[model samples]
Target: MASDPEDRAAAQRELASLKFAQAQDKAKQDPAAAEKLVRESLTLAPGDEKAVDLLGRVIHAQGRLDEAIQVLGEGDGKSCDMCKRYLSVLLLERAGKREAAKDFEGARTDYSRATELIPDATTALAVARSSEQLGDLEGMTRAIEKAVPLIRPEDTAAQTEFLGFRERTVLAAAGRGDVATCDRWLNFFPPGAGGDGWYVLQLRVAQELYRQKKVDVAVTRARTMLGSTHTDTLPANRKTEFQRFLADIYRLQGVGYLREGKLAEADDNFRLAMEFLPGDDKIKLLRALAIGGHHETEKALQVVKALPKETKGHAEVMAILESMQVADRLAEGDVEGPRPRSRAQAASAETPEVHVAMAEILFITPAAGVNKGIVRQLKKSGIVKYPNDEVNRYGEALSELAWAREQARGLGEGYLFRGPGIDARMANLDRQLRAFTRSRSSSTPTARRS
Candidate 1:
């Protein structure tokens, strides 16, 4: 124990150095003990760089990462190469452990902390990886962006690998519908330097610019993405994601044209979407709407005919086609009102004189789907008397036997019907009415209305 002030200060440094040396030996076999010893050394000599480095390393080796970083921070404001290197390596090991244990957020914290010590490519990649695992796509993207510049341009492999990671970040953002964020990553490379994702990003940007009412710019941006001068010419069957991205761009720009009352341009864009994604109901529906909006009801009807059967949207398409046909007739200046649609109105609908006409119309109507659902509901509610209502009603027994004959003749149920589905019962009723009418007229007899 020294007595004088200068002597005491000198002794403190010497004793702290000695304790730090002991801590180093303890670190290999017993990190907890080494951490305690290093802490005491730092307490005696608060700015001892070796003690700071040893404490961080020992605690980290003991799996106490957060505390290790805190200990490492002790000499952060001062220049000490050993402490910096130890902090960097300690953070990387901690991040690796967290990532392996599937603790993404913890790994992200460690990786990001490592970058603060040194902007190393390996650590930066780890940061991006952890961010991706955490579903922090924007964070992943920013991490890649910040780290890429740190890579020397001559290191082509590192640059190319970083570019691949950047593409992945862009793809993840696309999957989550984070289109606007994709633009921030564009400045990192020259135009088209990052691969096909750059075009995908441009498409999303066009969508947003269109949304914000930048019409000319939006159209220009969207057209540029398609590699076309005309808005109608979009790339087709490009990679799956590229096609989808292009289709989405067309849909937005098409709708924008539609809303602007530019029917021709709208048709062009909608058709381009169709070329990229054939048999897309939503796109087809939009096409029909555009044609109807242009007063081309016949063309619109043809578009509706292409919709897939037994789907809700298909049913809606049927309704739209019927509406267009009605509107087309109305445009021809007819005085007649549209037909009535209820059971009370069934005299005109169900009369034998109108049986075939009514059945044909009902078979093609969109309301048929709704009625099918109602039939299911009726069954579920235990309301229908029997599934054999066909054999008990007037003229029903005759129709059933007639269908048996028709079946023997290889006419199969509804084989001659002119509608969507084949219902054996409805086919029999139509056949019975037609046969009765032919016999009555040919035999010179006055038959019951049918």
Candidate 2:
């Protein structure tokens, strides 16, 4: 649209007003207001590069990212190359067109051209990320090749940004399942390079090794990183990431123990897994372990209660907790006298089903009294059939115990039983006790001799 003289002067006044409004909007963190001002500025001077840039930023900040890209593209060739590079990345990333459109490579070209126009380390890092994304390993190597030479050794920003580029290159290599390339990148890390990046990279390497089934190597690498005295020096975000990695390690360790039938060790690892995961994730693990009679069910519930109501798994945990509470009230009714729980009591009954469940989960030991009677019966009779099957019998009994424990954890009526399982030794002892009492009362000579 062509502008008349008066129309052009009025447009200038509107542009000036919006410039003031933009500052006010930013100060208030009012994205809506900022967007409105930028849009009005663009309307007043439709082809104004500054107006387009400001509007594009406001739109991107508001997450109307596609619209931002369209607005920014108007100034794509005219704006400073640095601005174009940033805008291109936002466009490519928000469009989810990274590899599909080969935009990362285009971004690399822009950054490379920018360096020819103005040499800078930030541009070098951008080029490195772009090359890594494009699977141009040698290009990545070359992009950062200039970085170290350009950087003064003591330049913290350059060093930090270079480390960032190196870390990303490692991640890209790992993503491509190119462990050899990742190792080559690791060689560049300085000997004393202790930071958020080092521990994270170590954990990533360990994870890759674990994925390759190099279990012992993975364990050693994880422990070495975790046990480092400087772990405390890591940033909060990095420490959270480290804790998540530890949780994953513990989960794998738990699976190993569980497969070997080592219930105690499995339970320990799973409990540690819950401790490091977020509340929602922790509850899921707790529910699974609670069904298996791990001892941390009650503690897990307490932790879930502490989470914000908006947490992802909150509703599910609350439902399970409510069902458990009802079951507890039902079980306690006969033992604690005929009393109905009040609504408030029902809601917050911290009853101890999980505690009792844990106590009862252990293998039931045949006490001395029971064993003595069984041995006596075995010695006296032709009733001991299939004597070689004792170990098999014990295993069957333990399996039954495991099933009962699973049921008693309130796994619903599907697992609950109508009757107690048969205990062969106890049954034999009962039968022999009845026969011995009858003989003793009849003045049997065997009882008198004893």
Candidate 3:
């Protein structure tokens, strides 16, 4: 009676299919018209997967990405493979536009969604790029990992590009002290894939670790690389550079140990450093400092004196000599007056002799006792001569020690007299200075006496 219900349903389905076919043919040449036809087809058969896919494509072609995405999303509930493929493509296109506009956040959103849909190398790489722009190192690394497996063997260009990206990521990680990330990426490359550049990268990572003050870790990493057979494959210049880098690391460690009063360890590291950087006078000076740290003033003095008179660190060496002489004079209870005809008194001397003398006095003075004669000599040294200077006598002494320490550090000699003995003495002087400051603030100043 109702015009045959079955026949009516069949007619609607046939008409919908016919409209969808027409829409597909016109999709490329006239997307606007194609969109209208697909919409009419969907009106007749509301949930047709093919019809919905065609509508999305036509809408995307007409540059209505948001509408197209909305239309395509309708078929997702039906698990339409074709719809998902089209949607992923549309998303990639939109992502590209966003990226071109420098809207990386929007681009990242689209790229990430597309990656979840297709899991293809191209989309994954796009996600990686966007993540990099956002400073998302973890996201960038994850995307790269996803892409590497998807890359086809025949796609040599893609593989090379991935490797290059990985190399940059590793270096960036190293620079930021992300040791674990650097290690993971480094192991991703097969043996010999990174060539000599690989070894250089390792050295750079170790150097960065050192700069960040992770000294023990840096030493271990550098030592491991130094012992690797792969090192022999490096070019001569690169090998030399690596060797020198290792030497520098050892020297730095030696200086650290020397400053901490670990004489045996300091001497051992310095010797190891000398093996790589043979005849390095800086290392020799460091060894001498180690001797001095152990209170072997004569041995330290002889080592310094043995250096050529025209050494670049002549000023530092002279300071060391003065420091030792002061120590010797203090030990002999000879602080009655300044030593006669000393190198510091010479007209040609350029060393900060006053600072050196004060540093030595501070280095040798026990925490429980203060030498009045040394105090008188310090006052007479004129370290507190500036009227406008706010620091008292003890503060001036500490300042001189600090200046000497900085000079030594700049010359790669480590902090001068940073051993426990000197540290204790300096701490004691600091306490006294604080006490003196409080007293001066609350009471009349004592008469100035030398």
lDDT per residue for candidate 1 within 213-261, as digits (tens), equals 5656655655455554422433343344445656766776676666455
Candidate with best TM-score: 3
* Model 3: per-residue Cα lDDT over 130-244, one tens digit each: 8888899888888887887788867666667677777788788878889999997776552234667677778788888988988888878876776766656766777677678
- Candidate 2 lDDT by residue in tens digits, 1-450: 246776877768676566746744673487778777766665666666565666667777787876776666654534543356556556445534443566886677666755544566666766777887877879988877765566665668777777877777788776666767776776664323456667678678777777777766666666655566656676677666666776777766665554344657766777877777754364353344343333333564576566676755354444434334433444455334432223213432232222222222211223334455566565455233323212113334334444534544454432211111112322332353345345434454554565
Query: What lDDT would candidate 1 get against the real structure?
Result: 0.60
Q: Lowest summed-lDDT stretch of 10 residues in model 1?
A: 413-422
RMSD of each predicted structure: 15.1, 21.1, 8.8
Cα lDDT computed for each candidate against the true fold: 0.60, 0.55, 0.70
Candidate 3, pairs of clashing residues? none
Model 3, TM vs. native: 0.63
A best-first ranking of the candidates according to their TM-score comes to 3, 1, 2
- Model with the higher TM-score, candidate 1 or 2: 1
Q: Which candidate, 2 or 3, would have the higher TM-score against the true structure?
A: 3
